[model samples]
Target: MFRWAIIFAVIALVVSLFGFGGVAGMSKDFAVILLVVAVILAIVGFISRGKV
Candidate 1:
């Protein structure tokens, strides 16, 4: 999931550079959402793992 976020972030950057505003904005938003989800999952995993 984190990897996918990075991929989409790169794609967003590239698209923005090429002046595709709509695509860039959407991809960037998706990348941010994925990144946030990945972080939340990681934190949850860490906390749960420590209990064992």
Candidate 2:
């Protein structure tokens, strides 16, 4: 999940560099969403580990 975030971020950077604003914007948004998801999952894992 985190890896996918990095991949999308890189893709957004590359696409923006090539002057594709629309695609870059979507890719960047996806990266942000993935990063949020990853953070949430990490927090959940930590909380669950404490219970175990």
Candidate 3:
């Protein structure tokens, strides 16, 4: 999941560099969403681990 976010972020950067504004924006959004979800899941897993 985290890997995917990095991929999308890199894609966004490359796309933006080439001047594909819309595509880059979409990729950036996906990257941000994936990053948030990954962080949330990681935190949840860490907290749950402490209980067991």
Best candidate (score: TM-score) = 3
RMSD of 3: 0.3
Query: lDDT of each structure?
Result: 0.99, 1.00, 1.00
Tell me model 2's lDDT, rounded to 2 decimals: 1.00
List, residue by residue over 1-52, the lDDT tens digit for candidate 1. Answer: 9999999999999999999999999999999999999999999999999999
Error of 2 at 17 (Å): 0.5
- Expressed as tens digits, the lDDT of each residue in 8-51 for candidate 3 is 99999999999999999999999999999999999999999999
Which regions of candidate 3 fall more than 4 Å away from where they truly are?
none
Q: Could you tell me every candidate's TM-score relative to the true structure?
A: 0.96, 0.98, 0.98
As a whole number from 0 to 100, the lDDT of residue 22 in candidate 1 is: 100
Instruction: Output the better candidate (1/2) by TM-score.
Output: 2
Candidate with better lDDT, 1 vs 3: 3
Question: Clashing pairs in model 2?
Answer: none
Candidate 1 lDDT at 7 equals 97
Cα lDDT for residue 30, model 3?
100
Backbone collisions counted per model? 0, 0, 0
